[model samples]
Target: MEKLLISACLAGEKVRYNGQALPISEPLEEQLSSYFELVRCCPEVASGMPIPRASAEIIDGPASLVLEQKAKVKDNQGHDVTDAFVRGANMALQLCLSNNIRFALLAEGSPSCGSFLVYDGTFSGVKMQGRGVTAELLTQHGITVFNVNTIQEFIDQLPLVICNQSFINADFMK
Candidate 1:
C-alpha cells in the first residue's frame, strides 16, 4: 500500500520550533491514520534549530529560500539558517525515495513544510502562495504534496495513490 508523509508538528509531535502542533483535521487524522502509515517530518527543527526560535520570514527570493540579511528569526542572534533548512529538505526527500512514498501532507505556511503558502521570508506578515523548501524539492522529484489545512482536498487525493509498479504504470497510461 502507498504511504503518506506528514509533518511531525501536524501530528502533534513536539518537533516544531514553537514546540506546538498546529491544527489537525480530525477526519483526515482518522482516515489517514488507519489506511496509511505516515513518515513524519519537521524540516526546520530537523536542521538543528531550537524550538521557540525566531519566527522567520522568507526574503531575497522564494525559489532559493534566501532570507533578508537583516531579518533575524528571534532573540539570541538568529542567523540565516537557509542552508540547514535545505539540508532538512534533502533529508525528507531521502525518506520519500527510500519508502517510495510520493505524496506528502505538509504543514502550510512553514518554511520547512508548507505545501501551499509560506511566509514571504521577510518576517513581513504577508502570506504568499508558494511551496516551502521541502515541498519544492519533493514536487521537483514528482512527489505530490499537500497540507492538512485543506483536509477534504487531500482526503480525496489519498484514495488515488498507487504504490506498486504495475499500478503506477496503469495510472501513468491514463
Candidate 2:
C-alpha cells in the first residue's frame, strides 16, 4: 500500500493545541483506511509542544519567511515558538524522506500543517492565504500536500496523487 502523511488531529487523535481531535467523518476514515497506509503526525506535538499548549500562528509574514528565519511563530500569549515550528517542519520532512511518503493531507489552519490558509498573525481570528511550515517543507521536498475539506475531495485527489509518480520521482531526478 502507498503511504500517506496525515495530520494526527485529522486522524482522530487528540493532538491539537487545544487537546481536541478534528472530527473525521466515517466515510473519510473509511476511505483513508482502504486507500492508503496513514502515517499521522502532529508537528507541534512532535516538536515537543505539550497537548493543550497555547495556540500559535505565523508572525510578521508567511510561513516561507518563517522558514527563512525572517519571521516567527508566536503563541497567543506572544511568546516565540518559532524554533519548535521549524524543528517540527524539519522532522516532518525527515519522516517523509525516511518513509518514502509522497503525499500529505494536513490540517488547513495550523502553523505547522496548514497547506492553503493559516490564521493571520494578529491573534484576532483572522485568516489569510498562506502555507504552513511543515506543509511548505513537505512540498519543497516533493510531497504533494493537500488541505482537504471533505471526504469526497480526499477521494477525488488520491488517485491523482497515487498515479502521478512524476511528482514523487522528481526529487531523484534533481
What TM-score does each of the candidates earn?
0.80, 0.88
Error of 2 at 158 (Å): 5.0
Give the TM-score comparing model 2 with the true structure, all chains together: 0.88
* Candidate 1 residue-pair clash tally: 10
lDDT of each: 0.70, 0.84
lDDT of 2 by residue, 35-151 (tens): 778999888888999999999989998888898999999999999999999999999899989989977889998989898899999989999999899998888887888766633
Q: What residue pairs are clashing in model 1?
A: 17-52, 54-73, 54-74, 57-121, 57-122, 57-123, 58-120, 58-121, 58-122, 59-121
- Tens-place lDDT per residue, model 1, 1-174, is 557888888887877667687747676688876667777877777777778776765555664433322322232245666667777788888989999987788888887677789877556578898777788889888888877656565565545754553233225423
What lDDT score goes with residue 166 in model 1? Answer: 20
Please state every model's RMSD to the true fold in angstroms.
4.0, 3.8
- What C-alpha lDDT, on a 0 to 100 scale, does residue 94 get in candidate 2? 90
TM-score of 1: 0.80
Best by TM-score: 2
